[model samples]
Target: MAKLYVIGIGPGRRENMTLRAINALIKSEVIVGYTPYIEYLEELVEGKEIISTGMKGEIERCKLAIESVREGKNTSIVSTGDAGLYGMAGPILELAKDIEVEIVPGVTAAFSAAGELGSPIMHDFCSISLSDLLTPWSLIEKRIENAAAADFVITIYNPRSKGRKKHIEKAVEIMLKYKSPSTPVGIVKNSGRDGQEQIITTLGNIDYKKIDMLCVLIIGNSMTYIENDHMITPRGYDL
Candidate 1:
């Protein structure tokens, strides 16, 4: 039976990609993914049949992969970061009812960003995407509020886009009510890739201009602090 592999490419860098992911891609006959992700894997996928589409074409991309698999072609779909974390894993799994599916995990942007900063996610943490395209803003806000109330280290994805600008600002406002104004915040752009940039700021004074859709925003809990310009969240260790 033909198999479908949903692989995470991990920040679009060869070194960041897992051995399993690379092997799956090597074995697959067809590779399908978003254009940018496909372009990132050009070196590895040189001889394979590559199918790509633009943004917001997720369903189309998944359908193509499913069709390819049904035709007895080994297929792999690439996604940036962990496939399960706001990547193509969910859609592919949902669309793949009878096909044998293998999900290859990789480093997510949250962890990549955390590594660039310090250990801001050392304690209890939860990830939330600020994108309101599929999820309603009211529900997103509620989750953010509840997470803040629970003091979970928050890693926010898709914080800002060209069309949506005020969402991040509003999210910060909601967090400020539960967290301190001086709460440690780390912003990492293009993590694990060339020209990567990171900065440590405060919740009350975040440089909004520095953030984009490609960036990950880690808002630390009350227990989080900065030591020697590095963000750190204690895990209740005796030190």
Candidate 2:
């Protein structure tokens, strides 16, 4: 039996790579990941076998990765952000149910963005992926409405992409219907790396078209505020 390690590479920087994950990668006979992720860590696996898959076909890629291990070859599958959240962990678990799998966690973009914004996630919040690829828009619509209705601070992942541009605006519309337009919106691009851009805006000011897959947008609840140019969402548990 071979080992299948599901790993999250975090964002882009090599320093953010986990020691354990690196060790696993070094031990694996093959490293499989998205094209960009493979390119990002290409140096680490010099001359090693890598099966790079495109952004789509994530499920098929996972199946191939599982098969590699099931066939007695060590494999490491890569994901961006934490493997447990919106990463390979879910699909890998769903696909490799009968196969022995190891989930190696990594830093998620929400936390990286939150840390740069000074604890917008310190309080109660919810995360929503605006992509309607695997998830239906109706279900996503209801969740957005309910998130707004509940006044929960929302951390939006994959808020906007090439074909799915209106989801973020729709989310903004839903949020504004229930909350104030002045609600703080913090956006972090390429968080925790060079070329990072951070912005503290409002729901009234969020331009959906400007966001991309690499961006993590944090929309604050009613109580969320900006102080000293830092976006802060109170934990609601008074210290």
Candidate 3:
């Protein structure tokens, strides 16, 4: 039987890795992931044959992992966040094509980002991937506008890259159309890792020029507040 392991690496912290995920990693003979995801497991993945590639190479990487599994060697594919939530799970499963694939979930970056900002996502919120590589920007804009109109807190992923800039600012502009300029915005870059940065700003004060691809941006709803230097998005219990 060909067994494929779809694992979640959980942000960038080694300590954040779960016991089940660790066991899965240890048992795998070969590991496939993005370059950064592979580097994160360097110490944990001593001796396994590793295949690392760049961003947007997920389809190619998944193929390598699936082929390795078919050859009777335990093979695993790694993702940065939760396996299923905008992570590697969907791609891996699509490649599985009726094979028995094991899914080991991990914490998503948004949760880690939210924790760094002190539970800003504790209430009802929606997660959005700002990258328009696989999806259309028009669709992305509609969701942002709808999320803003519904007053739902939004967590954005893959905000800005070297080639793709200004998209995040466009998202902010959409939010600003429906949300107040003073609404709290939480920006977390490389959360749960060294060189981590956390900033709390507002729709009117955010500097989009300073943001990078790795940064995760959170735009609050109209009810969102900045309290004692923390960004908050209430669950609407307040009168």
Candidate 4:
């Protein structure tokens, strides 16, 4: 049976990708993904038939992958970070009925960014994407507020984009109602990839201009703190 593998490449870096993910790509006759993600795996996908599309073309890309699978071609749909987390897996599964699907998970952006910023997600945490394309801003804002109130170490994805310039600012304002201005915040850009950058700043001192879609913002909980330039959140371990 032809299998459709949903593989997460993990921060768009070969080193960060799991061996299982690489094997799935190797077995796949066709590689389908967003243009930028495809370019990230150019070397690995050199001989495979590439079906690339731009952002917001997820349904089309998933359909192409499904079509390839129906034609007896082993297809792998690539996504950056964990396929289940704001990646292509969900859409692919939703579109693929009566089709065999295998999901190969990889390191998510939150974990990748956390590694570069130290251990900021040691305790309970919740991830939320700020992009209001599919989900309404009202819901995203409410989630931010609830996460803030719960004091969960928050990992924010799609923090900012060109048109959503003030979204991050608004999120910060909501968080401030529950969290202190001095709460630790870690910003990691291009995590696990070349030209990676990390910044440790307080919630009050965050430079919204320094963030972009490619970056992951980790807003610490009430228990989080910065020491020796590392954002550390304790998990109730007495030390």
Residue 74, model 3, lDDT: 88
lDDT of 4 by residue, 95-190 (tens): 899789999999999999999898999999999999999999999999999999999999999999998999999999999999999999999999
lDDT of 3 by residue, 121-185 (tens): 76678899988888999999999999999988899998898877889888888988889888888
Query: Judged by lDDT, which candidate is best?
Result: 4
**CA RMSD, predictions in order:** 0.9, 1.8, 1.6, 0.9
Query: Could you tell me how far off, in angstroms, the CA of residue 193 lies in candidate 1 after the best superposition?
Result: 0.7
> What local distance difference test score does each model get?
0.93, 0.86, 0.85, 0.94
**Where does model 2 exceed 4 Å of error?**
236-239
For all candidates, what are the clash counts? 0, 0, 0, 0
TM-score of 2: 0.92
Error of 4 at 110 (Å): 0.7
lDDT of residue 62 for candidate 4: 94
**Distance from true location, Cα of 84 in model 3, Å:** 1.3
- Could you tell me which 10 consecutive residues in candidate 4 have the lowest summed lDDT? 39-48
lDDT of prediction 1: 0.93
Q: Rank all candidate structures by their lDDT, best first, as comma-separated numbers.
A: 4, 1, 2, 3
